[model samples]
Target: MDRTVEHYERIAATYNEHWTYNPDYVRGFSHAITDALRLTASDAIADIGCGTGLYTRRLYEDVRPTRPILCVDPVRAMLDQIPASPGLQPLLAEAEDLASGRVALPDGGPLDAILLKESIHHMPDRRATFDGLAGLLSGHGRVLIVMLPKSIQHPLFAEAHERFEQLQPDPTEIADMVAAAGLRSSVSYRTFHAAVERERYVHMLESRYMSVLGEFSEDELRAGIDQFRHSYRDTPLLRFDDHFAFVKGWVPAR
Candidate 1:
């Protein structure tokens, strides 16, 4: 987890640029997330592992504009990239730390929702972390874990897909973890399509848009790009099959 934080810190400056090529795609995903969670303007939410505040900002704009959100991440550089706003509070903390109370939320009464977006895989202990987060919720609070399951195919880079499969947890496993944390949980699936120009997609691959790409060697990356160019030479746009799972755990009202 420490090394993962370092990697994100190094790439924090340009991280949001990875998704800039498709604004509608991002907006759609955010809308789906907001709908799935049934978030309201009065709900107090926390976006854990919110890198560069991409989705965090979207949540504010598309869902709960007036609500204050706590954006937490282990990387200070990533947190720094989040724009300064009265509604968005940046906290320097890891998932496990937040769960264990090593890091505390800023004097808010209680959180109505805690969102773990593409971040659960990075935590050291999944069950313990979930248990900790469960402790922080308000009586009716829910913990939402948004993730890309291992079953989905990565369209651009094979190496990144392989690494994702190696790290991603199964949806059932996450649900069980939530249940073990003493919360009743359910899982739902959604598909988001991101259409990017072939050239831009290749550029994102070459720039190592995902942390998984960092594991590939320079030669391997070049080879992957060559393979992509050959495979999509005739296709001007690449449509990514972005399949995701929303695992929700409810904290019963006291």
Candidate 2:
């Protein structure tokens, strides 16, 4: 199993719960997605690595798209969490499948929008992936990538930040990749906020809410949490900024 899939499997049950703790963050990012992807009435939309359909469900509710909203993910465990809905279609395929033509879209031709929120980094060969996705776009189709910066303001242990910086892809570089793939590309930034009870935030850290936290050993996690307790300002609510880098690519309308 892919290590990321394994990590999602371990946290699949709690993955949906992950959103509840950051309702504002969810709203901000989802709104940004709708605007960036212009999803008010997209004919066909796909959310690659649509983890448990947390954001997919939100997008569905907000946009109420007429056509099917495809939810794609490689991990069956995570894909299973997206409940049956009128317009939600769950596909068990990795991003590479779409890139390599191994998996076909419903219409087998064009897609109005393709989303790679927080999942682009997991794609092993992004250049080819971008090339393939660019080919899949309808006349007015678009691909939007939402990802993290190298550093974050979240109250994680110091080492977790280091690990994230090592793994996180620079958004400008990804935008350049899109341009090199022969599509019009642009890069932008969006910031969101999360306010949760301090204990809930601590639990999130313990749950290893992100991949960076997954790297810590059990003892290291405990120590990190302990440090967080001591170091973070003693307060009922934990508030922090979440920074998202957006890279958008599209084929010009023909």
Candidate 3:
């Protein structure tokens, strides 16, 4: 398994314990998905990397789609967090599963809205994966990929910061990939101002909340957090913008 996926797999059960999203931040992101996808009551939705269905459930409520929503993820444990319910179907698979025809949506039709929230960077074959998605879109459908810019603003331990920049792709390049797949693509930005207790934020680091943090050894992570504490001791409340690059792709009107 890919290390990123492995990271999630190991942390699946306690996923919610690692971090807490500001309720306002979640609301903003949910709104961004609805607005960018221009979702409708009848749109069949698919959340490709719907970990624990945290946002998926919220999104389901906001869109209130009449068609069944497919919540797909590679980790079975993470998928299990989403309870079986009316209008929701959980699929244990990766993006490649859909692209390679190994799996099919329960409804067996093109999707009207596709979401890849915080998970686009995990795909090994971006071009091929997106080409498949473009082909799967209904005429009026849209795929909204939520990713961070290659560079980010969140304060991190020095080495962790450098490692994150190394790993994260430039969101602009992803937009280009979407265009190359023959879809009309546009990029937008969203920012969530987070104010959290400094120690609470540090615990998120120790939990390896960010995948890049997983690359660090236990001792290294301990040391890194120690350094962060020493440097940020005076910062009782850590304030930063949780930034997002919203990349939206759609089949243009014929």
List per-prediction Cα lDDT, in the order shown.
Answer: 0.83, 0.85, 0.85
Model 1 backbone overlap count: 0
In TM-score terms, candidate 3 sits at 0.95
RMSD of each: 1.8, 1.5, 1.4
* Predicted candidate 2 versus true structure: per-residue lDDT over 1-254, tens digit per residue: 77788888888889778677668778777888989998866568999889898888889887999887999998888888889898899999988888789998866868889899998888788888878878888888889999987788887878788888898889989999989987789989898877778788888888888977888889998998888888876677877887889999888656
Between the candidate structures 1 and 2, which one is better when assessed by TM-score?
A: 2
Question: Per-residue lDDT tens digits of candidate 3, residues 76-182?
Answer: 88998887878678999999889777887776879988999988888898889878877788888889999988888787889888988888999889999999988
Better of 1 and 3 by lDDT: 3
Candidate that scores best on TM-score? 3
lDDT of 1 by residue, 1-254 (tens): 56687678778888888897788878888888788777888888999999888988999987654667889988999999998988899989888888888887787448888889998888778887888788888888888899878766556556666777887789889988998888888999988887788888787887777777777789998998888788889989877678899999997656
| Candidate 2 pairs with clashing backbones | none
lDDT of 1: 0.83
Cα TM-score per model:
0.93, 0.95, 0.95
Model 2, residue 164: displacement in angstroms?
0.6
Which portions of model 3 miss their true places by more than 4 Å? 18-21
Clashing pairs in 3: none
